[model samples]
Target: MIEIKNLSHSFYVGKKGKEREIPVLNGISLEISQGEIASIFGKSGSGKSTLLNLISGFMKPGSGRILINGEDVTSFSEKQWAAFRLQNFGFIFQNFQLIPSLSTFDNVALPLVLEGVHASQRKLRVQEILQRVGLLEQANHFPNELSGGQQQRVSIARALILNPQIILADEPTGSLDSETEKEILNLIRELNRQQGITFFIITHDEEVAEISDKRFYLHDGALVNGGVSIEV
Candidate 1:
């Protein structure tokens, strides 16, 4: 569903009024297919999130091409990029980044709200996704009213409520207890098949790689060729 070629990104640091180049992504390239669950694994400062941000068009690479569903997104204008992301991508973060003041239902409905979806239709979609995430009962609660795991479920509900073509999660299970982590992972697996949304996650968990169709191990901004292990 996505293709990246010759991607490289670097940040310039200003020290004593002098500029220094700090490279994060160095000539990396990779592809992900539709309906496949894949991962990018690496240590801290490995450029994994940089690659994800680049793909999301939130950040651009100094040099590279990013193709989503065969369209060149590298040069899309800001408005175009925003619309594209709303229609094509769902994002989940390590911290369950829900709006504390909004009810779970409202948080889940924010994406559609911004898109001008009517209240009735938005209710149906948000409720359905909340149910899928096992958070139907918690929908009326604010972010602080739920447990860590429950909050993450609401975040997942918010992300999936858009029914986007791709889901990008970064350290999804990092903050959960092992048992809760397993619960969240299983939800992701089930959602993958039932929704047919492409999954591209950056994780540090071994079991996550074991469950993926393909896995990429990144180091020092370069993709380790054939680095991601295939599902056995």
Candidate 2:
């Protein structure tokens, strides 16, 4: 579960010496329930990615509170945040973000190995997730050998390998062809339905929004429907 309060973030723009401050998020706030899929839609510079970064602790908000499972992430120390991210969060990026040198299986197993899972157990779990993402046969292949969709599937497997409570995906389907996009969407939707893995994905795609339990719009750094959306 996620709870955000009065969240705001900004960055500098213009020439370095004469830069101006531009706000990316302005008092945005919302809550995402366990097992829910939420999509954020916005224009090119509308701060959708910034909001995801804030939630993931990659970028700290200037002012606000972010709570995960009732733990206020704003209060986390550097090490604490690292631990929490490791144990509770999974990420899928538009680029797939795979390590160029690592084989698919190794990349998928990285998270579990980082958690100190035993080698045998990690191998089994990695294989299981790769199978889930339909990448079992590609296990020994390097990222460069895979197509865009396959690489993204491996990224999904890497994210799921840890079994994190929440998945944060930024344009997971952005780089694929329409048919491949459909495949990825169906995969993610089924994962959400069958495994109850909550997802908060930032996407410009309407089809992605349609699959979500609900949608939110971001513009000028504000969360649309935040105040008026009923609890039910």
Candidate 3:
């Protein structure tokens, strides 16, 4: 339930008065249906991550419109974006993004805490998600105490704790071993199949793109595969 139209973005480098524009995304347009698993494949500096950031409201596009569930979020203020993101989006990062000091349970419970949920309810929600991600036993452990795969599961649990409509994953399996990556990928597929949560993944790995219902190749700040391709 996301639509992007004529999306473009650029960054300026060099000194203030004599800056040069570096285009990152150019006229990008795409639609992701509800419950769809979509992946964007691109090498470094191809604007795949930029597209995700724009859609996630982390930054505004230079010239474009972004619609999520029929509402134009292109001009949302920081406050509005924060509220909307908490209500609508989940995020998983390559680095897992877990706090070393917080245990798995607390890490996964942070979102609910931010939303002001009561302790009892937060406990139940966090436990359920942690179990779903197969990390219940590791709940008491800190991020540094767990393996890489376990830490990523903690990240996934944190993302799922709020029951977000869409999960935006960036290089989700990047730091894991091959076997762990396969396990994580299968978990993602199962989550999509069973929960109907939409997934928008940005990855360079073909194996990661293989799990998506639709895959697109992005190059030189433009989508090179017509913005939609089933083939890997």
Candidate 4:
């Protein structure tokens, strides 16, 4: 459902007149099929996150093309990207990225609210997703009131609230304990199995990579090990 071709990106550092180019991704090409859980493993500065950002439309690649669900999104304008992302993508971050002031329900409902859904419909959708993530009881809680795992569940609920076709997770379990990590991973697997959602995860943990249908190793801004599917 996702494809990257000849993707490369660089950043410039130093003063205005005299700057140096630091390459982050180089000729990266990969494809992820619908309903598959794929992961990219890399150490710091390996460009794994950069690849995700480019695909996310948060940053543009210096040279390359990105296609999602047969639509070429490489040159999508900001407005177009916003609309497309709302319909097709959900994002999870290492930090959970939840607004501390919002209740779990509101946090999960934010996307629907942005899309202009009515209150009654948003209420049902948010409650359903929160229940699926096992956070219905915590709906009234604030971020600071919940445990790390619970907070991450809130993040997952928010992501799933939109019924996105693909979820881009970055170090999804980074803030949790080992047991909690396992729980989150299992939840991810369950969601994929039941809903046929494609998952593209960026993480450094071997345990996280273990759950993936396909694994890729990134090093020095390139794929050191081809993104090959593993026999399940």
What tens digits encode model 2's per-residue C-alpha lDDT throughout 1-232?
9988999988988997998998889998888899999888778788899999889987778999999999899867778889999899999999999999999999999988788999999988988898888989999999999999999999999889878999999999999999999999999999999999999999988777778886888877887776333221
Model 3 alpha-carbon miss at residue 110, Å? 0.4
For each candidate, the alpha-carbon lDDT, in order, equals: 0.87, 0.89, 0.93, 0.92
lDDT of 3 by residue, 1-232 (tens): 9898989999999999999999999999888899989999989889988999999999999999999999999999999999999999999999999988899999999999999999999998888998899989988999999999999999999999889999999999999999999999999999999999999999999999999988888999998865766643
- Pick by TM-score: 1 or 2, better one: 1
**TM-score-based ranking:** 3, 4, 1, 2
Q: Count of backbone clashes for each model?
A: 1, 0, 0, 0
Q: Which ten residues in a row have the lowest lDDT in candidate 1?
A: 223-232
Query: Each prediction's TM-score against the native?
Result: 0.95, 0.94, 0.97, 0.97
| Window of ten residues with lowest summed lDDT in model 4 | 223-232
> Tens-digit lDDT track for model 1 on 1-232?
9888888999998886798999998887788899989898888889988988889988978998999999999999889999999999999999988898899999999999999999999989998888888889988999889988998898888888778899999989888998988898898899898888899999768777666888888888887863445554
Pitting candidate 3 against candidate 4, the one with the higher lDDT is 3
Cα shift from native, residue 76, model 3 (Å): 0.5
| Root-mean-square deviation (CA) per prediction | 1.6, 2.1, 1.1, 1.1
Which residue segments of model 4 deviate by more than 4 Å? 226-232
Q: What would the TM-score be for candidate 2 when compared with the true structure?
A: 0.94
